[model samples]
Target: MLAPSPLGRVLLHLSNLLVIAFLLLPIAAVTLGALQAEKTLQADTRALLPPEWTLDNFRVILSGGEQRGAIFEQVTYLPDNVKKIRFAFTNSTVIALSVTVLTLAMGALSAWTIARLRYRWTRWLVNASLLARFVPVITLMIPLYVAFRQLGLLNSVVGVIVALTGFLLPYAILILAPYFDQIPKELEDSARIDGCSRFGAFWRVSLPLAAPGLASCGALVFIISWNELLIPLILVNKAEFMTVPVVINSLVGDVHVFFNLMMAICLLALLPSVILVLLLQKFVVAGLQVGGLKG
Candidate 1:
């Protein structure tokens, strides 16, 4: 590769800075909105910054809508879902984790079979997964809702987990199969010779060797499941089972909006996934770079 000329290099740097600002502008606006009072936000849309900032938005939410202080006392018309932030958070966590675990286990087992068996049908299965990936999720929404309702799974976290797992499982198999195909068969052969059955060989040998791929798959699945809105919205009408996205939607109103509180809740909703990605950053990079599973 050749280095750019001086003028070209300057243009590249300027373009990069512009892209960064473009991406970060909404986040900066949200942070600023979360910090200042809603009245101040409304009064000064043209202001670069708020004249006065307050922590009352965070306090009101964290207190479970019980402590609005004298200044915010008139803000008593909170919705039921807004008051149940903690419950919605719990529901989101449980559904995401459950989906991740189920998808990984089933996907790894299927990937191992498809990779090792290498039969004509296995190849067909891989092709089917590719086909499934191209199918629009919204296309399946109505059928899934009716099926779940018939199966007595509606209005439950388990139903959401099952639905998400089914949709996400194909991607998991797609990721893991190529990685598994790359692993030398000698290791599994040695395990079998030592009296390990097929499941034993996979559980003890292949799984550990594919840790990076598994970590990547798990993170992807969990993040998708955590933020899923359509499936949850379709399956659950009860407030008790609402996830963060559904709860957030409930807070929006045509009139008398609370921008600061909304921004604060949005920030809170983003924390878990952000933290999870940061904690598993190394695994994700290693898996994507070396797993050779892009196919």
Candidate 2:
């Protein structure tokens, strides 16, 4: 290949700089906004940096306790039953963890079978699972709500977990199957030759190799379930059962939206997923690339 000219190199650097700037601008704005002293978002004839910064917003929104008529109080106007932000966070954590565990278990088993066993029905189910992912959550909301209510799951954390798992299962299967496919068949065959059952072979040989993929899938599902709003809003109506997104959404209806509190809640919500991604990012990136480019 011909070496780039000086002018071409200059343009390339400028283009790269512009792309970085475009991406960082919104993030910078949000970070600054979150740190601002204003209770509500209002524009002042001031520079990008706020004149004052305070942790009071964080205090009220987070661990700040026992204030009447606050969202954390018995109730304020929100479509959901989340009377308190703390309850919502707890509900979100429980549901998200439950969904992640269930999806990982089911998706890993199903994907392993489809990748290794290679039966006609397994192939069909794999393809069908992918197709199921394309179905919009809206289409199934009414049916799900009715079914969960019939089973006494509505307005409960279990209800949210059950609903989220259905949608997230397909994603786990899709991401994991390719990674399973990448594993060396010889490893499984050797274990089988040593008189290990198929399941045993999978448990001992294949499962270890697929850890990166599982971690990635689990992280994705956790984030998705944590941030979900629509299903939780529709299915749940108990104050203690609201999830984080639903709680933040309720803040919007206030006659004067408390931007500081809202932003603080948002910042807190971002922490768990941020920590997860930071810790497992290498595996996540690798799994995604492999799943996309290979099997």
State which candidate has the highest TM-score: 1
Estimate the TM-score for candidate 2: 0.86
Q: Which pairs clash inside model 1?
A: none
Q: Estimate the TM-score for candidate 1.
A: 0.91
- Model 1 sits at a Cα RMSD from the real structure of 2.6
- For each candidate in the order shown, give its overall lDDT on alpha carbons: 0.84, 0.76
Most lDDT-accurate candidate: 1
lDDT per residue as tens, model 2, 181-260: 98999999999999999999999999999987898888778877877789998898767777888877766766554555
Candidate 1 lDDT (Cα, whole model)?
Answer: 0.84
Runs in model 1 with CA error above 4 Å?
282-295
Per residue, candidate 1 scores C-alpha lDDT tens digits across 116-194 of 9889998898888878877777888899888988988889988888888988888888889988988899999999999
